[model samples]
Target: MTAFVLVSGMFTGTHVWRETAARLTAAGAEAHTVALTGLDGPCTAPAGGIDLETHIADVLTVIDSVGTAQDREVVLVGHDYGIHPALGAADRRAERVGRVVHLDSGMPQDGVPALAAVPDRSLRARLAAAGGRADTGDVLKPPAGADEWRLWGSTAGVPDATLDRLTALAAPQPLATLLQPLSLTGAVATVPTTGVLCTRNGASIETVQMMVGFGDPALQALTDPRVTFFELPTGHWPMLSAPAELTDVLLRAAAGEGHRLVPADAAVPPAHLRPFPLDVPEALRERHGNVDLHLPDADGPRPAVLFVHGGPVPADARPTPRDWPTLTGYARLAAAGGAVGAVVDHRLHDLSDYERAAADVAAAVEAVRADPAVDADRVALWFFSGAGLITTDWLAAPPRWLRCLAATYPVLAPLPAWGLSGSRFHPARAVADAGDLPLVLTRVGLEAPEIAATVEEFLAAAEDAGADVEVVDVPHGHHAFEGVDPTDETREAVQRAMRAVLDRVGRHGAP
Candidate 1:
């Protein structure tokens, strides 16, 4: 007999698990839902406000009572913020837990507080300002309205009635529960783990596997046989949107019957770290602060292409984007074609860093144009991946020197979870303002659904505005296909995009 313990994320409590728990019970499994202090039910928060430890203890009590009485270990399932307390409890009583399931949540590391999970930027800033101190008596309130539900997580596929009920029953979460760092003795590492990804909420099984393929030491542990994965087609709140499906996944996860990710090949370098697909002779390089200029062999003042690498890349990422093979390869390719290739390193370490990143890129462009070896009157800005958002500014108002704009596997619109609904970085919306500025976009067939949706949105906008846009298709390519999928199609698309940009740059006396 399998005993399943459920823990609901921030705001609501055991009540949120009603449908899923009932389904589990009907399936002949023992279902127990935990009510964290100050959340749902009659449990009042103790003086000084309940912290993470209090919630950990709350889960521990249930685990002990159920495990002892039934004489069986339980499968602990934690959803969203609920994963914190569940992990803390599991760490403390690893022997009593059969498996730990992470439902639509990130893997919380030791010493990191649950506050990192808070999705609202304003709310996060406020909590950080208060220092999450219990003495501050700060309580983070749940989303008050229907529209605000997305601040917590994606509400895709969730019914209006469910959203109303969730909003009504949502409780105020103590700052302490979010502030206190999770403590672990490392005992839970040996426990079999299962991850339940919510695709519409921005994460999917494929993304996770791709990250693992990055050769990131931190993510390599996920390739372990003990770590299995299951993906839900719904959003963050699976219990409300697809209770039956959630129940089914949970049952299979408990049985150790989920998908396993293949370990990355040790011989081949990680996709991003791999050599660029194109083969071009290296160009003479000169560094100008954050920007690196790859000069063509032929001298007299040549046109330049400023390449902006995509990110939300970690501040401490190795080799930086300027040094990456793909960027350098493109730079070399541009130089080989009689144009100076300029790669710039920007501060796009977080989603919020787009403004600073744009400033850095603008500065880089000026530096490239000011160089004696480059033609100041002819320049093209090429963006990649997330860097595509920065193109909004250039697209809205094109300068005479700006010949063309190119993007490869770009994110033209912000995803729902990013909370950037009305921001200035929306290139899809900004495309309407682009008047006759030539635009080139290289789209991959195997791109992530969310990113692909943004590309589609941008294409529709471009069509409506009658913008001079040329679409280059990589039929069987994936995002970052330059290094990941090295096929003839990928090579042809790359060369085609280069020719289009250079052709625009070659035009004399541009408008």
Candidate 2:
């Protein structure tokens, strides 16, 4: 039966949680420390990727286990940036939770990512002082050791590998969630909870202040009750720096003396499927004339459907796939010939200049047309998601490639982010500001009204620009389409997209 939930602080995980969990168990409380995705593994370089909400859901998963196993709810705890997930977890699993303990964690009273709460002076200095390795290009990774991290200041030591692990393991968290005002009116804070602050480091003073703000505003500002705030002289990690003392404090928590509250309803999915390994190829280089050719056998001749991959993320990554049989990237290749397959490697949004990105796609098209194996005349263009920007520009500004366009819930509207939403003439703006185009475009047909609206706008605009557009209503407007390929319905839609393109290829077959 579940008894206690021992959450770790930011930058650390169940590995650090081991000492605490063991002590709790020795005292007769069943304890489990949730190891969230990205944390358990290395992280992607500072290129900016990682999902905060999902980490919160992972905490919920541990608490939820109590529903099926224990009659009594578990005591939840959060540390450092860990406060975000811990609070979020409790919010989603209130019924299964008895109390929440914020162990010197930063709370987001104002929709800010915990990263913002982590002492900025410390991070900036570390980034400036330490030079990272080559692969990530200017992306700063965490210091390797505890001492090294101490030198870095702000955070505890996490590995350089953590970044690599995070890139593949973590998804890009929408900055909006971090920026959205937090409302715990009905959740964890109202429940039994406590805040245990370790005032050992001057580095965390700012973070602790932010943590105080996360509590109920009345207590935070006017007058207050309902929270037990404890301060210890130990440094960042009480469990490691001072385990026995931390144990005593936690035992008090086991007795239910202090714990603030948690909002009920934050469920973070724990682990995502592992990412397929990426091996960047030599010939895979982008050349001129919009060359988009697939190797049926890697050793085979020309192929069908050439995908123009997008930028920002590595061309390869896709949402975790529910269907394992069909490998990603190779999907279009699989569908080629009579099968209908294509591989798209998108331009790097932050890296490439305007002309260079468009030139890359243009080269891909030219090469694909020149390929002996493919019926250059019959070749098709498949753009995935935001990739429509480059594809659109290629089709709009330059000479046209073959016929037809297939977009899977491609992004249509400008970002809803404050500074992000604008009529600026950048990538998103280009698509939003385009002229008449061709062929069909499918926005996602999901239950989410927002996604539906966005897809509709993309289709409407594409149509206005002269492109034939179709909006396929995916049963549920979930992101499941990218990964869950096992479903027959999903398969059918994919076939339809390819078929439409194929028919278009037949008509617009190579010039």
Candidate 3:
């Protein structure tokens, strides 16, 4: 059986994990909870007696007592303040721990204590007043009652009963746990780690990386080769507010499943995939382009599809919010079929910016091809909606290395009603110029009459020009039908189209 050890945060003990542990136990797994030293009860250890090392020992003791088996796996789960001790212990007893999960918690650096990372002065003062110093009693606690919990933002999504229990059971945290600096020799770095972020505050891996510099050691730890990231829509204490979901995530983590940040209905096909951020220069992130990559689980020289998303072009001047789940899901589907998937964000202020967008696409394609993990010659382009207009340049004179291309409900011809002029961007004009390059076009039957007309006209032009084109029609589908309302039909449609694209591309054809 797999062993799951749960470590709770400041002022809270294993009592907070009752629901989560029960669920894990019910699922036939061994669940152990840790109540660290000094905070076990009132004055168990003198205020000044306990420090970071003491807690680390406490965690190690629990791991040792659990015993071990060759086939059995030991997973250490740490939340908030508890993360430091759990990770520290894992670093020391690296062989005993198989995996570590950090739930809405801060990671520890060798010389940095948990306190140094806190920026709120008022909170720091409150902590100091509660005994976080040498002269102080060395313990910190949340003020009593439900009102305080709400005011401190700790009660979000938490039930009244759980909140009351937490308030009553909460203990004073040992100040040293925050004040003492943590140290590591990189041993724990090898242990697989997963971060489950509570998204109630709208925080994501990208946002966090932006908040903390991309080079921060803590952030680097989160993206380590063995690490996978997950997001929970509820508040920080998922064990209390979202126990079932939290337990499910823990089970998946123990089983070594990869990332799954999408919603339940997002229809993301299962595949071994990893986040692959392109190394775009900071100078180009603003006006030029930005891209996100999802590579197949298999190693080196895999086929790849460079995706370009549809757009009307956001006028807000800020970066457009990309639907990461959908992008990753598409990539995963492609990965499942034995190819790497990439989503590129290019300049899209208006239809007039096609040239600039095309340049971005070209740059993104080069980057994907240059990746050691990708088969440079086996590359294809996939475009969706408005972004399909940019395909005009590709369809005009297909490159020798460009294997094939696919488009969905594309705006092949510019619509004057939408500020697009045929003279500026028109894929129909390029169809006649398209050579023997194979192409796949998906037409959504329920699409706007104008778009349907465009699809018909483009198909006719291409066929008349002797272009090798294949058309797949979704009878009752609308634009972005799957994302509009994911269903059995839409799901299967997407899978079918992806499979067809991979097969026709002749690049590592996906099964």
Provide TM-scores for the models. Answer: 0.91, 0.39, 0.50
Best by TM-score: 1
Q: Poorest 10 consecutive residues of model 2 by lDDT?
A: 263-272
Q: In model 3, how many backbone clashes occur?
A: 0
317-428, model 3: which lDDT tens digit per residue?
A: 2234233445556766777676777777677654446667888888998988887777887888998877878888889988877778899878787542232442446788
**Model 2 — TM-score against the truth?**
0.39
> Candidate 1's C-alpha lDDT?
0.87
Candidate achieving higher lDDT, 1 or 2: 1
CA lDDT scores, all candidates in order = 0.87, 0.49, 0.70
What is the per-residue lDDT of model 2 for residues 1-511, given as tens digits with 9 covering 90 to 100?
Answer: 3377776644445766666778777877787788765555444432334356666777777777656555665878777666777777777666667777777554455354554454434453343344232122233344445434443222222344543432344322223223323434456556666667665443222223322322323334211235555655555566665666677777786565543433211242211122222221222322233233334434333335665543333233333121111234334333442423444333543322324555666666666666665555455566654455455464445334455555565544432211113222133334443343345554445423333445566555555565445555456433335343335565556556656766665522232
Q: Which scores greater on lDDT, model 2 or model 3?
A: 3
Which regions in candidate 2 have their CA more than 4 angstroms from the true location? 42-49, 68-71, 122-140, 146-148, 151-185, 203-225, 258-511
Worst 10 residues of 3 by lDDT: 279-288
Per lDDT, what order, best first?
1, 3, 2
TM-score (C-alpha) between model 1 and the true structure? 0.91
Tell me how far the alpha carbon of residue 467 in candidate 1 is from the true structure, in angstroms, after superposition: 3.2
Off by over 4 Å in 3: 41-47, 117-120, 125-133, 150-154, 209-221, 260-511
Q: What are the per-residue Cα lDDT tens digits for candidate 1 across 1-511?
A: 8899999998888988899999999999989999888888533333456889999999999998884654565999999899999999999888889999999987899999998877766677677788834562457667787787886788988899888888888887877888899998899897899999988877778767756664456777888888999988788899999999999999999888898876766666666778888888999999989999998988588899999998777666677789999999999999998899999999997777888999999999899989998889999999999899999999999988898999999999887666566468899999999999999999999998888989999999999999999999998999899989988999999999999999988733332
